[model samples]
Target: MNPIEARHWISAEDKDLKTVSFFHLSFPEQRAAFEELIQHTPAIQVYDTIWQQLQELMKTRHPAEKLSPDLLQQKAAAHIGNGPADEYGVWVYYPWSQRLVHILDEAEFVEMRTSRNQHKITAAEIKTLAAKKIGIIGLSVGQSAALTLAIERLCGEIRIADFDTLDLSNLNRIRAGIHNIGLPKTTIVAREIAEIDPFLKVTCFEKGITEDNIEDFLQEGGRLDVLAEECDSMDIKILSRQRARAMGIPVVMETSDRGMMDIERFDQEPQRPLLHGKVPDDLSYTTIRQFSGEQRMQVALNILDYDNISEKLRSSIHEIGKTITTWPQLASAVALGGAMVAHVCREICLEHNIPSGRYYVDPDQLFKL
Candidate 1:
C-alpha cells in the first residue's frame, strides 16, 4: 500500500512527515552519480516531486535576485533540513510498509496543502480560523460537518464527541466502511482529519458528552467557538444546548430531512430558548434520560417542529419501532447537513450574523416547479 493510503500507520506515530532535503547535484559529474544511484534503487521515485518542488522553494525565497545553481542547491538543502540523503535526510519509518519515507516539514506541507483555499477564504480569514476552536457532538451527520470544516481549514482545533461505534448500518450516512466497524466514531473521524492534515489539533471524546464531562468539553480549552449538536440521544441533544447557552457558545444542528438546519447564536441572545423553545426550560435532564423510545421520538419531532417537517420524514416518524427500526436518513441529506453546518460555522466564527433561527436547505423547493 502507498504509505499515504496506509490507514493504520497514518494514525500512528509514523504519521508525522520528516523534513527531508531534496538531493541536489551542483556539478555535471555529481548529477551523473545521482542518476546512477536512482537507477540502482527505483524506490527513490517517490522523491521526484520533492526534487521539482525544491526549485520552486528556491525561487520563492529569492524572488528579486536570480540565484546561481550552487546557491540554489545550498539553500534548498538548508530549507529542507540540510544533510546527506541517509545522514541529514528527515525520514519516517512506516511499519506497515516497512519503508522509511522522506517527507516535507510541517510548514511547507501545510502551505502547499492549503494553498488552493486562498482568496476565497482569503489569507486573513485563514489566519483567523487557525486560532479558533470548533466543537462537534454526535459523529453521524456531524462527521460530515467535521470533515467539511477540517478540509476547509475553518478552525485550527476541533473537539469531537461520540460514544457510538461504527456499525455496518451506519455506512449509509456516516461515511465509514466495514473496516471501521466496532471502532468508535470519534476514532475514525479523528484519523481521517489527521490524514488530511496532521498539524490540525483534534481531541476526541470516546464517550459521548455527559453532564459530568460537558463542562470540561465546552470550557476546557477556553470554550468552543461553535458547537454542532447532532446526536441521536435526546438527553445529550438538549443538555448540550444548555451547556452551550451557559457558556455563550453558538450552536448549530442539522436534521436529515428536507435539509432542515437550525443555528442558535447563544453568544448574541443568551436568554434564547434552547431549540427555540421546543425543548422547554423546565424539562429536566433526568426526565429526558428516562423517556421511553416513543417519548424520545416525540421530543425529536417537537424540536423539528412537527408542522414544518417534510412529508417523507413525517411519514417515517410513525414507522419507528413498528415497520422500521429507527429514523431513516439518506447520504444526500447527511452531506447537505455537513455543508449547511460548515457554512454557518464559518460565518459565526468570522463574526457574521447567522442569527438564531431554523432554516431549510430544502432541495425539493429549490428545484421544484
Candidate 2:
C-alpha cells in the first residue's frame, strides 16, 4: 500500500501465483514507537537476540487485535514446555507468532474458496462434513489422510497433533522428504495444508497426545468430528477408539497391506456402544483401557498376516513388534489403499452405513479389494 511496502513484492510475467510481500518495520517506523510505549522489562530484552533474528519475525504496535493475549496466554499456559523462560522473562509463544496467525487465516481462505466450488463436489450430502473435525494423531498415514480430505473437500475442519519429527527414514512414506528432515511433523504438515488450501482450519498440537494432554488437544468445541488412528502405538489405538466412541464420532483408517483399505467405524449415532456399538454398554474411555493387548491382537488378526499366522519367533515379532518395517511403495499397488479409503469416506460422508471391518489384498494381486 505504501511506497516502501511496494519494494517487498516480486513479480514475473508468466507466473500464476498471487503475490504477497513481507516487511520488518524499520527502526524509525511503528516498531520503534511501540518499544517506546512498553516500559523496558527484563523479559522484553530477551526477544531481541533470538526472536528478532528468526526469519519472518515481527515487532508489532499496540496489542494484537486479532489474537487476544488473554486467549493466547491461556493457550501458552496449557502448551508451553515446562523449562525456563528466556532472559527477558518473555518466552517465544504461538497464537502470537506471525507465521501461525497467517496460517490460520490462510487455511480458512483456501477451504472456503475450495468448498464454494460446488462444481467439484456436486453432492449436497457433504454439507454435514463441513463442520466435521478430524483428529489426526500421527503424520505419516495421517498426512495421507489430511491430503485426501483436503483434496476431496470432505470435511469442514481438521485438527492435527504429533509429537515427533521428520526423520530421514520417514521420507519413504511421508509427504515430506530430505529437505524437511528433523522438522516436527505437525509443523511440516501444517505448512503442507496451508500450501494446498490456505483457508483450511488447522489447530496443531506440537505435543503428542497422552493421558495428560488429550483433553487440551480436543479443544472443547466438540468431540473430534472424526478420529483417524495413524499412530503405531497399540496403547494409543485403544485410547483413541475408546475416546471416539464415547464422543460419538465415526473413525476412518487407510492401511497399506500391499494396498488394502481398512475402514473401522466407531459409532457416530447416539447411545451407541464403543467399537461399532458392538461392545460394552457403560463405556467411558477409561473403561476400555483394558482392551490394549487383546485389541491389538484382534486388529492384527483382522489384517491378513502376509506370512500366514506367525510361527514361534515370528509370533513374538507381530504380537509385540512390526512385520512390514517399511511401508509399501506408492506405485499403483500402494495407491490402491488410498482409493479404497476414499470409497469408504464417500460412503460415510454420504450417509451410507458400511458394515465395520478391514479390507485388504495380496501383493501379487493388488486392487482385488
Candidate 3:
C-alpha cells in the first residue's frame, strides 16, 4: 500500500493540465493518516463539501448506515475540511484532506449545475481553434457559468475576475466550497478551472472590474468572442455592455425568473439598446434608471400580487441580494439554466450565421428557446 491510495489530490502540473490522484496505503497506515493528518475537523470539512453532492446520488444519502462500507471509504479521501463540525452544517476543518469546505445549502439558496451532453462541445470547430479568452466577473453566477464552460473544454483560455471570496452563503449559487473563503473569487475560480481541465488556459483578474480598467480588463485576451456579464454590479453591467459593443463583440446576459432563463443578445446591432447604450439619445442615464426602476417594481409586484406567490417565497426574496432577486429558483434550475444558456452562447459564437437573439428556458412551465 502506498501513501496516496487512501486520499485524493487535485494536481496541476503545467499551464494546462490537472488530475486527481489516489494512492495505495496499508489500511492501518491510512487510518493513521486519517487520524493524524485528516483531523475530525478537516474530515468533516471534506464531508460537507460533498454532503449535498453525495446525497443526490443515493449512494451517499444520510443516516450513515445507508451508505455501503466501500462508499464510506471514499468519504475519507474526499474530505474538504480539517475536522468535524460541531453541528450538522457547521464545521472548521477536515484534517485528512486539509481542505476548507463552505456551507451554502444551510441557507437554502442555490444548487450545483451539470451538463447533459459532454462530447457535444469538444467536436465543434471552436475546440480545434485553440482556447478562448473570456473575463468572468463575480463568483455567484459567474462561477457556475465558468465551471460549465471550463468542463466543456471549449475555450482555449478563460480569465476570471472577482474581488470577493467564497463563503457559506455563496454555496447556494457558487461552485466553490469553504476552503476558498477570503481567497478572492477570481483566484478560486482560476484554481478550480485549472484543476478541472489543465489543457485550458486560465487567467485571473482578482482586483475586481471597474470602468477605468474595463479596456485593460480584456487587453490580455486580445479580441474576445464574447463578454459574459455575470457580475452583480449594475454599473459594471453598463460599462461592459458599452465596451463590448464599441469593440464589436457579442455579449450574453441572463436573468433567471424562478426556474426560467432569460437571455439578452447584443449580437444583432448596436442601435438595438446595448444595455446602457443611448436610446435615440433622448433617454438620459437618470431617465433610464428611473425606467429600469419602474420595470423592476413591476416585476416584484407581479410576483407578489398578480403572480400570487406565497409570503414565504416573497420573504425569501428579501434575504437575497438585490441582483439575485431578479431571478430565483431551486439549485437545479439555476445550475441547468447557467449551463443551458452557456451552451447556446458557445454554439452561436462558433457557428457563424447562427441566429443571435434572446432565449429562455423554464423547467416548471417547460419553456425552452
- The Cα RMSD in angstroms, rounded to one decimal, for candidate 3 relative to the true structure is 12.6
Residue 50's lDDT in candidate 2: 28
Residue-wise lDDT of candidate 3 within 37-148, one digit each (tens)? 4454433434345455434433323445666656654663354345432222322222323453433222221112212232453434544434456556665666777787
Where is model 2 more than 4 Å wrong at Cα? 1-120, 123-128, 268-343, 361-363, 366-369
Report the poorest 10 consecutive residues by lDDT, candidate 1.
1-10
TM-score of each: 0.79, 0.56, 0.56
Per-residue alpha-carbon lDDT of candidate 1 for residues 184-257, written as tens digits (9 for 90 to 100): 78778876776566567787777788999989788786789999998888898888888888889999999878
lDDT comparing candidate 1 with the true structure: 0.75
What digit string (tens of lDDT, one per residue) describes model 2 on residues 1-369? 331121110112211122222222332343343344234432332223322211111212122545454544544443324532222111111211222112212233333445445555653555666766667777666777777777766676677777888887777677675777877777776656644554446666666777776765554556665666666654565566666655556766655544444455556444444344334345344543566766655554543443652234234455343655432344343245545554566567667777666555555554335
**Candidate achieving higher lDDT, 1 or 2:** 1
Question: How many pairs of residues collide in each model?
Answer: 0, 13, 49
Residue 76 Cα positional deviation in candidate 3, in Å, after optimal superposition: 32
